[model samples]
Target: MILEYSNGLHVGGDSVKAEEIPNSKDRKYYILARLVDGEHLSYQRLSNDYFISRSSIAHDVELIKALLAKDNVSLGFDNSGTFISGGEIVKQKVIKRIVTDLLRAADDRSSILKLFIDSSSITRVEEIFQKQVQSWQLEVPEYYIDDIVISTAIVVDRGLLGHHIADAKGNQLGSLLFQFDKYPLVYELIKGVEEAGVYSFTPDELRYLSYIVIGNGFKFFMKDLQIPASFKSKVKLLISTVSDGLNIDLTQDTRLHADLTVHLYQMFLRLQAGTTVINPLLDEIQENYPQLYGTVWYAFSDFGSDNHIAISDDEVGFLTIHFQAAVERTKSAKRVLFVCPNGIGTSSLVSAKIHRILPEVSLIEVVSQVDLVRQDLSDVALIISTVQLPAQTVPVANISPMITTHDMKTIMNRYIDVSMDGSEQEVDFSHIHSIPFLAKDHVLFCNAKSRTAIIDSLMAMNEWPNAEQRNMFRQTVFQRDTVQSTYLDNGFVISHGDPSLVSHSCIGVAILDKSIDWMSNRADVVALLMIKKEDRKSVEPFMNVIMNGINNKDWFISRMMEISEHD
Candidate 1:
């Protein structure tokens, strides 16, 4: 029989009977009392905890809920997250179900007797016979009594009377008939034996006993007889008894792998009860069998928590310090160069102008076109020039003769700066004077007339004796008009290339005595052209440094433009 529990009692039999209800009443009452005492019970939770079906628990709860509602006693859940309603009542009902079922199983014998008898009348006869049957009058040998009890139980529980009739030797029943008749005699033999005692059995031995007594013909006969309601319970009891007798060492058997332990435990609970007994068995295996312990431990090792910590504070700190040093080094240095067409005079004039405007920066000596072609110009940052030099040389800043002091300041301040204070310093322009002739490759000096006229005159000369070169030079000078000589809002333009294509390397100077309308803006300034060759790769590095230096407001460009007109 599949036994279920509500309290301490088993709730099932071959057929459920009304007489078993009172046995479960105490549990039901206790459940009601607990509900009144403020404990909540959920049908699903109880079902899972008890290994019974939710439907069964729900039925029991419904009965309790209905009974409690009858007395105008309202059961309700509280806002404190507890089911204060019918907990005690429900728990009592569950207990009642268990107790009642247990008593029903213990008292009912008709259901047990019908297993051996086909006719219902035999059930009554068995009951009467049981009452009149003589109890053991004296002590008997344990083995003999055990044998008699087992045989009598089988006959009485299985209704073996139905199996008794004429055999093949039909004269009169012989030894087999006597054996059947003597079942009561065996019953009397063991009537006084204690109900509870410990026994053991191996699984194999239990299997053999089950096959011998319950398999094949016996199974068919029991089914045919429409046996007692309690016949299933008796069968279960017999099988359990046989299993206990076998005493199998289930723990050491590898056939019972750990993965199947839960399933095996559940099966055991269905057949018997209690899991506490399995603990000692497990401990014994763990101690005696190292291999099993190792395997199980290794299998579950991934689930173990790891608590290792890794540290790298020193390495990270060192890397951060090194990077900061590199950045600071780059931020402090500035370099520049000025270039023109000849080694004569204009280069010196422009170089002087640059130095006066930006005193903080170190300026390289001005070089003429020929000198620039001959020298290694790799380190130069800015090349101020009137002519287009070789590509891949340096960054160039181009300008016209009209460049003024304000224009120079604007160009330098917009593109380059040099200061260690980390605060912006403006370019100053107060001490500047007119030199008679600033000479390097070409001559440059302040005059009442335009400097462009002198440049045009120089290009027309044939004193160098290269006719084609002179013509080319003249064309190059004229082409400067293509830049429109217009002063933009921030600076002035004085070149032929597209403003967009011209690199910012060229420092354009604007020389103005008074504001004059040159294009749309007012200006009459000297623009120092800082133009590099169009194809210089090293130009970017130069531009980065010079632009940063000149972009500061306090720098050289303003100082150069502040030169006195009278000197």
Candidate 2:
């Protein structure tokens, strides 16, 4: 018998055992009344509310569970307690199934089925049929039932097919489909139109049609017709049919020139659709008709359109400023020396102004000509000097004596920082003890050849007093030349590799008293050599300090002239 159980009681049919079932009528009424009042019931509270033991309530719950399972219905427990699960239609199915079963028990299955089918309960009928088919394992033939009924129901109940038939040219199609809670009946209708030889349509027309199909179902003839290959031709026939039905005269109206206008609209739609097939067709048309393609693509092109305007002027300017600032920041290092002629107070003012602006830079006093000649400053990293010092001296920034404070800041920031915080102190080189110079019997002068021969000869001769001391000497003098090629402007290439110069363990100095017609700059130079193997390492640091120290323009010139005079 068709009896539906809700909670713990039989609801619809007489076949239920009332004595075995709990009287859930009061419970159902109470729960429904509470729900109506914006209150909900819980399973635990329900047990306590009825004044029944929990086990008795559990027993009643089991019977109700079995009854609901027969109709594929369920009850769920949440913060609201036991509630009917699934859609409203699912609950309706349980009720309808019970009614149908009761009718069957009364031997009225045919009348009940007829009543269900005749009613506007298409969804209920489908659900009942599906349940029966599933339960009995019946093979229901496809196409017997109404496809539109099922499809439309699914469309309305659950969103589907919306994306397929949306107006592709419209920007909000994605957002609209996302909010779609119903199945896309309109999309299906449009697909039917496509099937009925109306594939081509203007975007506006498609949008209008979409609204119509969604609001009202399509006409029977529209659904029945098959699509033609030439959609424009089909659309012309349609427009003509409509015009004829309305008896409208369109002799002067180009819109009534259905074939041409419809075809153009269809082409516009295709372009917006971004269909892959159209691109190849366009390419072929251009190739076949070069003059037409040229007119369309180039000659008649509108350059004044908003899309063609240059858009990045402000953005480019912003990027240029950002890059300039970054480069200026990167150029700023620490330690600088300023050198200029005396009596131009501009250097002092520039240095003072730079110090005020950039506390990070330490402004050393400007060195005058006298100071540049006599100052023994070898610790400076950058020399910001207006005076033209020789290149061998140091890396210098040549600035005018009339330079502004801002210009001085720019120069100091570009080259090195003059004012550094005192936390980072300068390196102290005071602990490195200097060794006394030892006299040697045999001295070797290197022009160019094998340095290895010179080293070997020095070791064999033992001319230097100590091996340890001698090795240090060789390092300072010989190995330094290997790091960089030594070239003198006097056409002489002095390197440690000369074999003729290898027989000594002592370093010797040679000087040219006058400028030689030797190389590009015509520089006559003083030459120095080291001839000891054990002294190599010690000799390197010593030479580095001396060469770097003598790189001061005034100091180098004075030392060179002193050697030349002695020679």
Which candidate achieves the best lDDT against the true structure?
Answer: 2
Cα lDDT over the full model 1: 0.33
> lDDT for each of the candidates?
0.33, 0.37
Q: After superposition, how far is residue 146 of candidate 2 from its true place, in Å?
A: 77
Model 2, position 180: C-alpha lDDT score: 24
Candidate 1 error regions (>4 Å): 1-335, 342-346, 406-567
**Residue-wise lDDT of candidate 1 within 478-547, one digit each (tens)?**
4443212222222222222222232333332333344333322333333333223332222222222222
Error of 1 at 88 (Å): 48
Model 1 residue 176 lDDT? 23
In model 1, where is the ten-residue run with the lowest total lDDT?
302-311
